[model samples]
Target: MNARVLVAYGTKNGSTAEIADVIADALKEAGLRSETRPAAAARDVTEYDAVVLGGALYAGRWHRDAVRFARRHEHSLAERPVWLFSSGPLDASAGERDIPPVPSAARAATLLDAREHVTFGGRLEEGARGFIARMIVKQGRGGDFRDMERIRAWARGIAKEISKAGPASPT
Candidate 1:
């Protein structure tokens, strides 16, 4: 049977959720069974063989819900093959080079023993409710910086790694 992977994410303006969907799609294409969920709504990981947790960066900090999810599911997470991602920075920096995880994400990686943590570009557009977000869009400094191809490629790598393991073990 194929391994089931949970692609969970926390997003303020919904862009991060879209990223999670893309990741799940790539995982499925790579022959893994995957599901995408909002970090705050997902309550358990016992059914999944692996997890890919992602969050939106805010002022150098990870989204609060993502941090909470890690805390809530730490034990199950520790037993599973895990990956982390952060999507923020409405610029091309993520595609140009590697960006390290923020403080909270770093802690989650250590606590869960995640196989890897990756940073991806972000998008901020009109209709954002946050003051800073609205201001950035108004100032024309906000745009989609997420690289879809890069995101898919990274997910494929995760699929490859998981495929190399023996049959999926229940956690």
Candidate 2:
């Protein structure tokens, strides 16, 4: 039986999309079959054995499409093993202290019985933003804050959990 994982993400400047791809690569290295796609592009959750949903956090909240995807597919996701992640907070100096308050995505994920939720640092590029986004980026922030080692470790952990859960049942 093959383990199929769906990595769905919402990106603004494409940072989250890159993160999703990296996660899918890690899952593949862990011996699991995974596909990465935009949240809006994914049509059905029932086809996958496992789901990994990620979003770019703006003002401490996940993208709207991601939230809707979880809410719309809550029933199907609840029955299958799920994981959630958010990308934001470029201030590495804050460490764990920079963790945002309970994001709506996390709350919804909990209600849907997600196995794990994580907050990964995000990136912002210079000149790749509107006035406000650029202002936020100019505060000596706006760099690739993604921790690949941590990301790979988390993927490995998820792979282990999925391996233990075996394959999903055909409906």
What TM-score fits each model? 0.97, 0.91
Compared with the true structure, what per-residue lDDT tens digits does model 1 show for residues 41-139? 999899899999999998899999999999999988888899999999789999889999999999998999989999999999989869999999999
For residues 1-171, what per-residue lDDT tens digits would candidate 2 score against the true structure?
369999999888888888888889988988899999899888898888999998888877788778888888888888789898888777673235445424687676787788878888888888755676798778866888887777778888998889888987765
Predictions in order: lDDT: 0.93, 0.82
In Å, residue 38's CA in model 1 sits off its true spot by: 0.3
How many Å off is the CA of 156 in candidate 1? Answer: 0.4
Candidate 1 is scored at a TM of 0.97
